[model samples]
Target chain A: MGSNDAVRKVHRHPERQRVDRDALYRLLDEELVGHLAMVVGGEPLIVPMAYARVADALLLHGSTGGGFALRAATEGHTVAFSVTALDGIVVARSLFDHSMNYRSAVVYGELETLGPAEEDAALIALSERLLPGRPSEVRANTRKELAATRVVRLPLADAVFKVRDAGPGEAEDDGEDHHVWAGVVPARRGWGAPVVSALTEPDAPLPPSVRRLIEVPG
Target chain B: MGSNDAVRKVHRHPERQRVDRDALYRLLDEELVGHLAMVVGGEPLIVPMAYARVADALLLHGSTGGGFALRAATEGHTVAFSVTALDGIVVARSLFDHSMNYRSAVVYGELETLGPAEEDAALIALSERLLPGRPSEVRANTRKELAATRVVRLPLADAVFKVRDAGPGEAEDDGEDHHVWAGVVPARRGWGAPVVSALTEPDAPLPPSVRRLIEVPG
Candidate 1:
């Protein structure tokens, strides 16, 4: 085992602050999906979902027929939500001390069902959040489509934000002479080459949302 | 919400299947690092850890002095174990319907205390698993380091495997005509450029085990 495998409070770096409320919201808004875990019938169920931000709440949408979705809506059980992005691997002199630099958010809250108008707005917000201005470019949801969907909004108050950034901790014996290449190998995420749909008409121009996002910096 | 957002039983493709128990063991073995969650003092505690496999069981090592670790060892609480690899971003046509392609295992089992010899074997197995062949190259653990570590093993029978593979699913009517770019964005995991430890002598070569896995074939 690596020497630093301990999960004690001391190992939990305090310097990795939880920024603030707005920063937290920004992080949530920027991400397209999250993992939702809840205790249902005394057993834990974890499911992946795409989510949107509604004021100080997170909005999760699913089919009206999904077992978890129906149960969560009808019973109003509290749920745990988590979003994680692995940024880099931290290799230390001792194998046991190796670590991962990551950003994660964990939240617990009861979900509130949204009415028709609220649901539509939440869906649009989610689309826009995921692809910046993409919602305006794509065809809007039809009334029939809206009738078959379900949306749940959960307040963000009961969440815990945990993050680890910066380089790996330096060992007490770390020095110039130690000769350990002690520095971060940065990881970056961005779009790769886009593939046009096979059936897309030759006349249909590339959507502005995709073009704009590609131009913007992450 | 996109039309494919309804209840669907995701299929497991052949290439994604584990052909042998050895493959499952390798998956468990390769990911020596994990996050273990269980109830401690009536509240949930998530502990990051290094684990080893012995026969059909998984051994988790912790500091004998740690709170949750000690409490868990003495109380023998039931714990949930999960190991996940985020393989790719699966972009389906629908915003609410999009999903991630991932591999994850969830296990629920009671923890057990490991005997001295079992503990030693577990550590060696874990080290060799993390960096295959490292156990032979590096010096064996000292008696002091062994005495300071606490190892607990959790068995396999009570586990369920869930996975999502293949490309994203589209709604019945949201056919190939939608013109949206839809497919998976692949993610790769392997050793990055190795950083030689500053403490190592100038001409020291990377051990064979480390070199072997540096660029593992897909």
Candidate 2:
């Protein structure tokens, strides 16, 4: 589909549609998970997936077992991948006007399975994106593990990005009282103190990557 | 579908499947937004929507515009509504096993549009759920506003709930070194301080509902 084709256009609220390519990349880069929807056996199946944006494509990897990603790639079925960040709760004087502040992007396309040669690089990119500054610190993936994983890529060409970042919209003549408190309660995701695993050595220091992740703001 | 039917069962990881009805309700109740997926002209359209779970059904309301929810309801199409809560980020020594702690529920059913008589109560339930303890504080919805809103309900039956709530699972025989620090970094959603709207009266005291929301830990 074309970039601005009617099929991918935002029809519900035309005002919230965003066409900037950078905005779409920023949203994809920031979110850790996405919901993947595809038609399976004539029934729509939506599954939460861990994904990373690599260049112009989204990289998704799953085990070789009954994996949705593997099935979709093998069948060349069209899928819709959506990433949504709920920013806040918009409290309005009227219930009808109350809403949520959010940024969402939905991409539609068929996923292509990566070949064995490219799978290793894609896996490294996914790891680096999910756990920044750690790919070098950890041991490389073994061939057995790599063979059991399925990696797929979906391009970001046909996508729609919509954002509602402002506070509640209230009209002057809505008839609701003006004295009521109305605004936005921002919702944010933050990382708590990391808990060391049970099998870790007693004196193992916190990795620099984990430390940096804690220092960074979401 | 039966509670544990093959279609509703969590095939990939049967261990994470939660069969309790109360667990499904709790997950839906805690989450404020859900991804609604419906097939439109043979293409899957997934939209993040503000939703509230009442008793045995989810209440969703949208404007009379080209809203997907309204279209799905009007056409009596089958839709899948999914709610996911990311509890924590799992930091594992093995890139292959890295995962996120989360609770997700997907309900598959045809949406039923509520009649005018039931729309009012559904809207109130939605408002109360989103901004708890606020419906009584604000004025009731005006007739004009209610007339322009479309509400639909989807039952909680035929739903699947999956949860992953533990630290990273590691095998003793695994080749990865045990010296690395690996565990979970809890991810949580919290409300920031409320910012009063521009049209609100100056020095309008924070509503009790807003105050309560701030006090409650997410």
The candidate scoring highest on TM-score is 2
For model 2, state the Cα shift of residue B78 in Å.
2.1
lDDT of 2 by residue, B98-197 (tens): 7788888889888888889898998899899888988898888888877878788888877878889887888732867888888888886778889889
Model 1, docking class? incorrect
Reference-based lDDT, residue B72, model 1: 54
lDDT of 1 by residue, A82-182 (tens): 66565555544443444455666666656777789877788788667666666665567778767767778878876556566554455543242234333
Q: Which stretches of candidate 2 lie over 4 Å from their true place?
A: A2-7, A63-66, B1-8, B63-66
Instruction: At residue B150, give the lDDT of candidate 1.
Output: 65
Give native contacts recovered, as a fraction, per prediction.
0.06, 0.66
Q: Considering only N, C-alpha and C atoms within 3 Å, which residue pairs clash in candidate 1?
A: A2-A96, A3-A96, A178-B198, A178-B199, A179-B198, A180-B198
Supply the DockQ value of model 2.
0.57
